[model samples]
Target: MPGFPAAGPPGGPQRSSAETYAQVQASPEFAALRRRWRGFIFPVSALFLIWFLAYVLLSAYAPGIVNTRVGGSNITVGLLFGLLQFVSTFAIATIYSRFAEKELDPEASRLRAEVEDSL
Candidate 1:
């Protein structure tokens, strides 16, 4: 025990996982990152779910509406709505990517650097 390192390479004390987690959690940058993440995800998820449910409910209960033809083409309201699901998925993904790149990534990187420096 007198000659050996306690638990690490012996340059300094290694930080425990809990310590690192606590440090990150206490950081204002980390808190802001989490807030941005949840703020974007929750509202967008709720909106998408609501839109999807509306499409489903309307298709089931009001076929006359969704079945209506579009502009003399073979497409119908149902077709457009179905396509919109894919469109909305891509749109949300794009929006989130942009949001993360612009709003989240910088703070996240700063937090990461701080944690690494502390370690």
Candidate 2:
């Protein structure tokens, strides 16, 4: 078997998953997507993080609203805003899904094809 060149498996040590992924990512479309992600990913994540932090801070510091009554029970602006975050998160997800499907998906598919072809 040593001299026979023993077969390991499909997609073996001769070619790793990372190598395959790298090849995929190396495609023109994915390269562009990566570049676009470089431009958008961190900024979007950071903005949402800051937004969440702001919500928490407002919840903590905005005393007048925190003590206020709504329909005989208390519902602070902070609480309202914080709860709205879930809605905002869902909205963001929907928007991102649409964007990715419409814009990124086709490009990614082309990239994937390039990768596979290279292999």
Q: Could you list the CA RMSD of all candidates, in the order they appear?
A: 6.2, 7.6
Instruction: Give every collision pair in model 1.
Output: none
Over the stretch 1-119, how does candidate 2's per-residue lDDT look in tens digits?
11112224666756555676765555555568978666666777888899898887766787676556667766756667768899889887887788788877887776655555544
The candidate that achieves the highest TM-score relative to the unseen native structure: 1
Off by over 4 Å in 2: 1-28, 70-73
TM-score, structure 1 vs. true:
0.84
- Report the backbone clash tally of model 2: 0
Clashing pairs in 2: none
Instruction: Give the runs in model 1 whose Cα sits over 4 Å from its true position.
Output: 1-12
lDDT of candidate 1 over 2-119, digit per residue (tens): 2111335558677675677686787666777899899999999999999999999999999999999999989999999999999999999999999999999987777766666555
lDDT of 1 at 74: 91
lDDT for position 70 in model 2 = 67
